[model samples]
Target chain A: MESVILQIAARHMRPLLVILSLVVLYRGHNEPGGGFIGGLMLGAAYILFAMGFGVQKTQKSIPVSPVILTGIGLLLALASGLIAVLMGHVFMTGEWTTLFSGTSFELKLGTPLLFDLGVYFTVAGMLMLVMFSIMEE
Target chain B: MLVLPILLPLFFMVVLIFTRRWLAFQQIFSLLATVILTFFSAMLLIDVQQNGIATMQVGSWIAPYGITLVADLLSAIMLVTVAFIGVVIMIYSPGFIDKGRQSAGYYPLAFGLLMGVNGAFITGDIFNLYVWYEVMLTSSFVLIALGGSAEQLRGSIKYVTINFVASIFFVAAIGILYGLTGTLNMADLAYKLRTIDHIPYINSALMLFFIAFSIKSALFPFFFWLPASYHTPPIPITALFAGTLTKVGIYTMFRFYSLFIVENLVFWKTFIIVIAGLTMTIGVLMAASQYDIRKILSFHIISQVGYMVMGLGIFTVGGIAGAIYFTIHNMLSKTNTFLAGGLVYQRSGSYDLKHLGGLYKASPLLALLFFIPAMSLAGIPPLPGFFGKFFLIKGGFEAGDYVITGVAILVGLFTLFSMVKIWNEAYWKKEPENIKHGRVSRRAIAATSLLALAVILLGLFAGPVSQITLEAANQVVFPEMYINAVLGR
Candidate 1:
């Protein structure tokens, strides 16, 4: 017996929560939010969806396994570190680039951002894995 | 290059997480990774020998602020030993581990354990050491409980709870030490601590570190968890743990004591001497009473660790060199003994001595393999253990510590007696009539023989090995060289 109201609220809130998490992840390097917090928010959003719609429905929606996601995340982080080593610098020495240095709202990119993205995926995937396993039990 | 030893296994672990479904791939890939790591570590050892202590500041951050990976001679030798044991265990595992546990992420967890061990060996920051210890402990917890048997669970619970408390104590000490010194870089702490004149607080912090490491290293009163838990894991896992885990604790104790905590030598010396005597005597006496092969071997680990601590207690170059040499010998011998015990279990179908007999008749080759490490462990002449014990005893005599020298020699004799008891009960006695025996797996034979060969070579060539350990001892005693290397002075 699922609560219809809770389901409706979850349906309405998930997109917003996901978008907010992305915003947090994007601004993490310069602001208070970071990969771990953003990932937690993203995990919370999916967990909320699962809670309202049931784990089976959530699993059908996202067919990929969490373990694979964790693997990808770890590889990404490792690659980010190895990129520096390949360039003959120390491991994990951040490499930076500016996409539009002359513009007011310039886009900046770096290995640190890549590393954070890896952490985000790892945390989100790991939390969901734990949550779904517990929910199944 | 400094990161390769750590990063390689970590990468393999992540790769293993995905390849867990492919048993053959998992086995082959993990074995390849360990072999590569062993080569890399040996290369690193040689490089460090040439370069005079390799130091890497992570992410290009300068020392004293950033995380550092530093490998002096002590760290280099430890890394080489760990990687070698890891290779041996990987070779031993496919034949030893059951299929159920193999599919349950054993390879990943083993690599995780290696990552932590290597990280602990190389990290130059104190807080990072704590973090690496946590990494090691988490994986060990999983490995110990991998099978989910009642005994395994009970042992893991005891192991986890005690180690968790020790970790807490470790972090608390780190916190207090950080508070007092305002730095966590170990070399910087050494520098800062020398300038600070607060003896009482420093002594208190050192005591906390002593208690925490004592538990991890299985020192006298804190060693109950080791004997209770070690026999519960799979044979290969137990052998790996026997070879590496407690030695990490001892390594940290050696690192911190010789590097930063030597100023208060008087208190530590007397304290270590008392603990060493009690630990050696009590561990051997307890091993004499245990009938289980793994349990007896586990108890002897604690006893042998006492000799290392006794060397440290002596606080001289000869003493530390002895400790390092003993550590290397014990790591190989202990692992081999466990592997031999596993082989015996494979052949005889029981670890209980009362229910076992006639291994000598069943397999003369197995008896010889077991004898090499067992006698070597008992400090037989022309073996590595004898030289290790000799150095420690000689150091004790030179330091005017006759009492500990006496206790060490007595412990060695009892160790021999217990080894002989196993010989008498398991190897010499008649086989039980109804028991069926199986041939030991070739893989198991290969792994044990590799370690046995290493034992022989180390014994036959104790000169160069002792030279290396003496160099390590010199680096340990003189922290200034270590500080200069890590801090770029």
Candidate 2:
């Protein structure tokens, strides 16, 4: 019965939590929210869904396995570093470009943000993997 | 860039994690990754040999403010040695590591271990070194506990607890040093330390670093954890640990002593000499009593490390060169011995000397493969270990340190005695009536033979190798080149 109430609440809360996590991840470099916290928040949301809908269902909801997610995250982070080397800089040296220039503030993208995104995915995937394994046990 | 060696392994580790379910793919891919890494490291070594030193600042930050990766002759040599060992062990591991462990993330963790090791060897900042040490400790902790067996758990607990404490002390020292000097860049710190007046806090920081590194290197009075735990892991893991892990600690000691603590060696010289003497005598004496093959090898590691420290304690160019040479020889010899011991365990189904017998009659080829490294480890003539010991003793005599020199020669005899004990018990004794002999795999034998060949080659080419080590030693003695390379002077 408790699970049913949780399931109903989770159905609405999951999307909101995921969106908020994205917002946190996107604003991480300039604001208080960053990859680690955003990843943890995303993982927490999935864990809540799992608690309500069962681990197997939650696993099916995510297209990739959590461990694979971690691998992808690491690859992304490493690629960010490699990109700098290719640009004739040292490994992991951040390279920035103006994506969209504006009068007030430019939409700038850089390797550091990519690295943070990689960290976000890694942390989220690792926490989720740990949670799912423990729940299964 | 200087980061390729480290990054390659990390990338492979992540890929291995994704391919864990596909056993064949994981095996093949891991092997491929190791091969590529070996090539990359060799290239790096050659490049550094030609270019003096390679330094890269991560994220475009200047030296002293950013994390820098620097590969001098010492780091490049160590990197190549580590990569070579990684390749041989990776080849030997497929038949050795169980299928369950493989599927459960062995390859990924192994690569993670390599990543940590490479990172430690290349980092130019002290705090960054601490971070790399943590990375290494974490991966090693998982590798040791992979099976979750009772013995493994016991060993892993001890290993983790001791190393964790050591790391805490390491970080604390780094914090104090950073607070005092306002920099963590080793070259920058060297410059800063020279300009400042002697302070009591600097001595305290040095002492803290000494204790922390001593534990990691398994120096005397802090080495009990090594023998208690090293034999509990699987043979391949043990072999890898024997080759690479503790050496990182010793390397750090060499680096720190040469760069930061050289000015204050008068305060710590005798202390290091005494520790070296104790570490040598006690480690070999304990090895003589151990019945398990791996345990015996583990104790000798401490003994051999003592020899290297004795070189540093002597504090001369020849002494440091001898230490570097001995380090290279020991890394190969020790890993080969453990690999050969693993083969013995495989054939006899036991690591106990009492239960093992008659390997000589069963496998003469294996016997010879084992003999080369075993005797080399015992400082047999024409082998690398003999030259390493000779130079060290000569260095000791040159320094007029007769007492430690005598202790070193005495310790060498005991090391030979322990090696002979293994030969007598494992190869000469008659096989027990009920013992079953398993056929050793071709890959294991091939891997052992490859390392044995390396030992032989190093011995045969001692002149050129000695030259390289001499150059490396000179670099260690003078930190200006390292500083200039990193800071772009």
Candidate 3:
């Protein structure tokens, strides 16, 4: 934890890990990766930082408490499911629209994606919360 | 519509999580949510009763292919009973739960538990049922240890460890069943089990399920964890768990028993009957030896569960209906007894019956509140418990299972003896000198009275309630109807 090399390594690896996790999250709707794995990766990034900087520092750097983060995640997931109800579809039905389209390329978004994003936040926040609590002890 | 019962609590639980810092807001919002939940479940029961079984494929997927939620008469009844109990507990909790635990996510965890219970009641997929059990168990594990006292931590450790072992058994059984049948939809599995002539190790899988559910329901040998853990929490949490948790296991047992255990009936029938009798005799005998009021009631929960399983063992329309009815009565009365015990603790500053006395004079209303549920639990006339047992005993006699029928009746007497023991020690004995008295809040009393009122109403409306349960039992007894409802055949 005190080694300069390890600290320096953690700083650079965290951003790369976070970016890779985002890529995983974005590709999950139709592929192998999903929110759960992406969130775990993101949590691992935070874990690396905590290992280098200590839990108190990590807690201070985070914008909000983990409790609020988890709550917000649940709200987002519920909101995604509820949006379908507002759209007069069944609860949690995938309501999709193409965000961008071309002859050879297209991007689509749906409530399922929002649901996945919610899971990503929740899992990451919960993991950090547990890790921080255990580490602080 | 079917999704609402599960969704509403989950939505409200999230809201409560956000509002956890606001104790007053949490309490009021929780009461409001539980009231709405009760109304929704009541409407669900009414709708099902009027229209027959309700089925919904979530996300508009086909029943067998995607997740399905079904509310037959039995599930609806369970939903309604649990929702009503939720409302009562919400009302009781504010006065009983201290500020520390209240602010520490008590309300949110409660809703989480409610959501899980609702999910378990309605889910038509076996794997989804396991998921719901996890949700329910996780919330309960937290609630049981919220205060984190030495005693509570001890209780929670045993509770969590034993329950986790039971869950492992559940998953193992699910894996085996899925490998053999290739479907996790409950009705689909039931359909296949009936169609296929031979499936190796199916009975072993059934035994695994039996072990898992019996542990959950706290039947006989697996019940040791319940009495060990139930009394450690604050009385409100204990009250909530007493009312709804084990009953979910019983409900699932009934559901699975009706759907899947038809072929091995002869062997399993004798097996269940023996276990039921032992559960009743052992639980009551242990209860009779306890001086702590909470421990006595905790043991009684085990014994009462035995009655429901006894009816299950009988395996007739009358028997299943009686089991359902007994389940409803037990949930209401068990909670009432615990809440009343909380009130006793409020006034006496103790849960030890030896340290309590003269409550009948100290507060006549408290005495009456405890008396109502106590008598009902003891199977007195003009109470729902009587009819529940009467129907079970009648079914047993009808089916010529006379030995266990006699055992049930004797257990009923033993049950009365336990209740009378509590009454004498807590309400009738002379108060010891120099005892400090605490205030019993009017709100808590009123909340408890509401439960007592429910028990009385259940007794008064036993006719109609039994009619509904009989219809529910009919649905369970005839799995073809349920299979058709889920499979759309």
Model 1 CAPRI quality: medium
Q: Tens digit of lDDT per residue, candidate 3, span B151-217?
A: 9999999999999999999999999999988999999999999999978889889899999999999
DockQ of predicted candidate 3 = 0.73
Q: Which stretches of candidate 3 lie over 4 Å from their true place?
A: A1-12, A103-105
| TM-score of chain B in each prediction | 0.99, 0.98, 0.99
TM-scores for candidates 1 onward, in order: 0.94, 0.94, 0.97
Alpha carbon lDDT at B68, candidate 2: 88
Task: Compose the digit string of candidate 1's lDDT tens values, residues B219-293.
Answer: 999999999999998899999999999999999988898778757678888999999999999999999999999
Best by TM-score: 3
Off by over 4 Å in 2: A1-24, A31-33, A44-58, A103-106, A130-137
Docking quality tier of model 3: medium
Instruction: Give the range where candidate 2 chain B is weakest over 10 consecutive residues by summed lDDT.
Output: B191-200
- Put the candidates in lDDT order, highest first: 3, 1, 2
Better of 1 and 3 by DockQ: 1
- Candidate 3 residue-wise lDDT, A21-107, digit = tens: 999999998899888899899888988999998988888878877777777878888888889889998888889988657746687
Model 1 chain A scores worst on lDDT over the 10 consecutive residues at A59-68
